[model samples]
Target: MAKQKTAFVCSDCGSDYVKWQGQCGDCHAWNTLKEIRLGPAKGSGRAGASVADQRKGFAGALDSARVLKEIDLDAVPRISSGAGEFDRVLGGGLVSGSAILIGGNPGAGKSTLLLQTMCHLAKSMDALYVTGEESLQQIAMRAKRLGLPTDALRLMAETNVEAIVAAVDELKPRVLVIDSIQVVHTDELTSAPGSVSQVRECAAYLIRYAKQSGTVLLLVGHVTKDGSLAGPKVLEHMIDCSILLEGSEDARFRILRGQKNRFGAVNELGVFAMTEQGMREVKNPSAIFLDRGSEPASGSAVMVVWEGTRPLLVEVQALVDDSQLGNPRRVAVGLEQNRLAMLLAILHRHGGLQVGDQDVFANVVGGVKVLETSADLALLLAIVSSFRDRVLPTDLVVFGEVGLSGEIRPVPNGQERLSEAVKHGFKWAIVPKGNAPRADIKGMRVTAVAKLSEALAALE
Candidate 1:
């Protein structure tokens, strides 16, 4: 028998090291190094086999180099995931020979969404569902409870990578789903499942098989406490697309956003509502996020944000209260804290609103996270309204970036945003001067502001 070999690997960055250290040189994460045992070398027993035979499970073929212009550029058709919202986030549809990683918190309905999709796709194509975390009985029970057609879809409960690949070779499935890569292990490595070495190797082998076989691979991944995919960072790079399912525990809605996509645009958003039946796609997502009461309230302002190819209208809420402590508290939910501090300073400097001694709290309604600068003006307006105990008009919509010099900056896709707001019956809009439409839009009044002071005056 060949002697076993061991090496230290960083859990955070997947960096290999000859010896264990306190800190990883690449990622600088402290105490993340873990020992792993490697398998024997290839061709250990078969001495006469060629190099190609020894690397049977590896993906790809030997081909002669060709000129870039001479290579054919035929477009490959995409497979529909059976859910319109899901397909939208995937840049229209799922591409063959692609590896997609989807992660989310527990009870976020990651499994439910994929099961529903596979059941629908299996009606027309050969699809396989492999579960490493759940049992075959549990899956069948869920499907039966959800009233999914169980006749066509193939199911397997296995965790060994080699066995799964062997079954795939025999079945020749056009689409395959590994219900999480963490629990799946391989015979090549002695490390336990979910370890850095195991996840990295198993994903590589499966991705290789998918690429060579032209199979659509959907991988369900677990999220860390911080809501990021739980595995080696390289797992993200090896896949064709990386998406995340986001929703709070108490919230019934889930948002699927693509963080990385090689075939389509990134930052695309998809909305779904968890029902007793299963996951239902929300056609009008903006309505759900903008579901406020009939009466207008203080500290609330509406804003239009561009999400991928569409515009989303969401509400921004703020609370400003007198601080009893020497140091006032600043809290921001579903928005960046540092940006809130910066916006507060701009409000004081440019808008002449002094609330430094007050406790400021900001929140984006419906649990939607706003990462763009278009929410700057809306957030400042909400803060000012709350400070003055004034209620803004319910028909008003606001969007613009506030600069350090108090000038309002324009955001991309301005016309589309205003049109979306208008379609939703927003009669008034406060936008940057550059975003103002050349032709006046019917049923809507536009207030184009050049500076922060001008935006504040528009409120009066």
Candidate 2:
């Protein structure tokens, strides 16, 4: 037998260390190191039965490289999950043999979404949902409650990775849904399930099975306190797609975001509303984020933000108050706090707004997170409105990148933004001078401004 080696692994960031330490060297996390024993890998010259060496099924095949010209020109077809919103985030549909990792907070409905999709996928293909966390009867109850077609879908409640792989070979399923990789463990590994070693090893086995068998693997994952996918950081690189399902637990709305995709566009958003039945797709997402008030309100501005290829009209709201504390608080929800500070500085210096002593708060309505700078102008306008107690035009929409020097910079897809604003009955638009689209939008009147002072002046 080969000599067994022991190593310490950080549970928080999956960094391997030679010895025990109070703090992890890589993640700087304290008290996260755990000791684990490692045996020689499978297919080794000295092994009796290697951990993952048995390649009795499709994984045993090997192929040589072929010439580029010899490859067929046929296009691969994507399988639609019968859910438009899910398909939208997946760049049309799910590709065969692709491995997707989905992470979300507890009660974020990761299981519900996958269960619904698997039911839909079972209509045409052989779909199997293996649950390591929940019982088969519990899944059946959920399927009944969600009004899903359960007859076509198969369910298995097993946590053993070796058993799961053996079942995959016996079933030969095209679509495989693993409730979570964290709970599944291999008997060969002495560490408990959800350990870093267990997660990496189990995921590797499943990924190899999916790639060799041409099966689409959907993995449900847990999120850390920082909202990143749990387990080793390399787990994200091994999969073809990485997704996050996020929203407030109290709110009925949920946002499915694609953080990484090899076959599709990254940072794509899909909107869904929770109901008694199940998750329903939101077709007109612009209406969900925009406030439809007849009269204009102070500290509120409209912004046309691009999510993937779709344009969404979202409301930017800000509140300014006199602070009694030594350092005024700058709080932002759904918007970056650092960006708010920079915008406030620009407003005070260039636009001549007195906001240094006031406490500022900014928010993007309807639980939609805005990460781009295209909504900077609208956010600043909302801050100014709250500070000066002024109400801007309700029908007007604004979008432009605000620089540190208070310059209004042009954003991408200017025409799409303007057209979306017009489609939603907006009469006025304040855009960057450089972003004046070539084609004119009929209903909305566009005013191009180059400087921050010009944009503030137009609010009068």
Candidate 3:
């Protein structure tokens, strides 16, 4: 008979403990320890578990199990999901037998993305979509509303894990997508569906089955109230990649970011606009960002921001005004708030700008937010130029990270930034004094300034 013992395990990090305590020693999370069935009781401490007794069940099976070395890897070619942005996030389309985990907020269009992907993949290959949270009729209705083709795409409405895996084996589908993993459960675990144990086990089994059968699996996961994977943390580790979807509450534009990817670039971001025609990819994003009819005004500057290998030109707008309130308010949207505050302080102290009694609001024109620090200098210049009531030259482009001492700092890939500016027909680029590349671009001149004082002087 197998011996049973008691042990304490952390509910969060899976750390083990000898004694039950209110606080976990490893992760410092409170009340995370729960009693678990352990191995041997007393003398099994030093060697962890006695190998003498360890020679037991599954040993014969383990010795005989052999891994496949000549599996067919190129049997199924990747099916491109129509959208370029979506394809980039997926690392050059879907792999043959890869498993993907997608999570996001409610109504954030997790279903929309996969549904569209299925429709696109169905054009070339047979794709199966299994949904635990919705019925086949409901899925069909949504597909019709989204104008997606349904002839090649198959839909299965089942929640039982056994039945799901059996269907996949029989169908030999090219790609399998699970709408949400939280609702699927197996009979082996006593815990209910969506519980930590059930989720982890379900994901593990599905991943193993996908790998063995050579079916690309896409698992749609739910996010918790705290914006984390709804189930245990280990659920993320069992899969090959994770994609995160972020959107505003009002739903004007949505951002797709790669949280983890083993196949492609990590810095790539996909931009999509929510429209009546459906989620359309904005290929030329900069054109959509510029103001259409507004006159060229003071405090607004055009600068180039790099997103991965692509250079995106944006219009940075700032409104600086005198304040009647004792504490002047400074607000920033689509950029770092603390960094804006720091830039304002530096402008006041070193650049001799009177911003303390000014009410300022800065915006990145479009709904897209800036993540790269290279936009810092452009933003700072826009705010200063706006406060001084000076209209920046339309042919000028500025980008750099500013230091606390009011010095313009160099950012990565300066050459690419300049090349992009030159291609866009910008005659002048104000960059860091020493770091500007001497790379030649016809009809464009690069101006490198060392300090903000020098930049303000040149701009004026």
Candidate 4:
């Protein structure tokens, strides 16, 4: 019998070391290394020859090296995920022999979404749904409660990766879902389930099987407190696409954003609303996000922001009040805090609006995060409107990137943004001079600004 080997693996970065240490050399994280025991050496009688041979060429394909130009350019067909919003985030649809990782916080409906999708997809293709965290009865009950078609989808409650692969080999399903990678374990490693070693090995074995079988693999993952996937950082790199399901428990809306994608565009957003009938796709997300009151208040402004290939019109709100603390509070929700401070400085220096002694609060309505710089002009204008107790026109829209020297910079997809705003009945727009349309846009009045002072004057 071969002696059991042991190694220390970093829980944070998944770097392995021969011996234990206080800090991980790779991630530089303190006290993250944990000991993991290997079962045995391959082909050493303990692991057996069959297991060793299987790992030799897990992909099950061997070909001679060829020139890049000789490679086939035929597009691979995509499998529809049954949900339009879900399919939108996945480029067009799910790709065969591809691994997709979806992570979310607990009770964020990771299992619910997969169950809903699998039930619909099983009607057309051979699909298997494996549950490591829930029982078979529980899944069936939920499906029935959601009024889903329960006759077609195959269900299995298994945690062992080897057993799952064995079942997959016999069933030959077109789609396979593991809910989730954290609970699955492999027989080759002695580490507990959800450990770094267990997750790494189990995902590798399953992914290899999926690739060899030309099956679509969907893995549900858990997120850390900070909303990032909880696993070895390399786990993200191993998958073809990585998506995050974000929403609080109290909120009915959930946002699925693609953090990584090989088949589709990154940063693609999919909106869904939770209801009694499972997850319902929000086709016109812009409408739901822009549902405002009849009366437009001061400090409230509308902005056209680009999301992936489409344009989104969201509201930007600001509040400027007297500060009780010695250091004035600068708070921003769903927007960068540091950027708000910088924009305030520019407003004071160029726009001649001073709010340094007052507390400034900024928020993007509808829980949509504004990462693009196009919200710079809108945010600054919202703050100024709040300080002056002025109400901007409800039909007006704003978008531009503000530079340090107070110059308004043009943003990408300016034409698309204007068109979307026009569709929503916005009759006026404040944009950078570079983004101004050469031709008239019919009913929309375009106000082009080159500097911060010019933008401030437009508000008057």
Per-candidate local distance difference test: 0.91, 0.87, 0.78, 0.89
User: Which residue segments of model 2 deviate by more than 4 Å?
Assistant: 6-62, 73-75, 293-295
For residues 235-270, could you state the per-residue lDDT of candidate 1 as single tens digits?
888899999999976789999999999989889999
Candidate 3 residue lDDT tens string, 1-460:
8555656666577676778999988789898676644333222234566664343221111134456886565665666778998878878887766788989888777888888888888888788899988888888888888787888998998887778898998898888999889999877666688876567667776776776666889999988686777776666666777988878568777777777777777656788887665678877666666543457778888778877557778888899998989988878988888888998898888899878888989998776678888888888889988888888988889988888988888887788878777776789989886657766568888889888888888886
Clashes of 4: 0
Ranking, TM-score, top scorer first: 1, 4, 2, 3
| Residue pairs with backbone overlap in model 4 | none
Candidate 4 residue lDDT tens string, 33-152: 877776542223443466544454444344567999988656568899889999999999999888999999888788899999999999999999999999999999999999999999
**lDDT per residue (tens digit) for residues 301-350 in model 2:** 99999888788899989999999999999999999888888888899899
Instruction: Assess candidate 3 and give its lDDT.
Output: 0.78
Highest TM-score: which candidate? 1
**lDDT (0-100) at residue 436 of candidate 2?**
88
Model 3, residue pairs in steric clash: 299-386, 433-449
Ranking by lDDT: 1, 4, 2, 3
* Candidate 3 ranges beyond 4 A from true positions: 1-78, 224-226, 291-293, 321-330
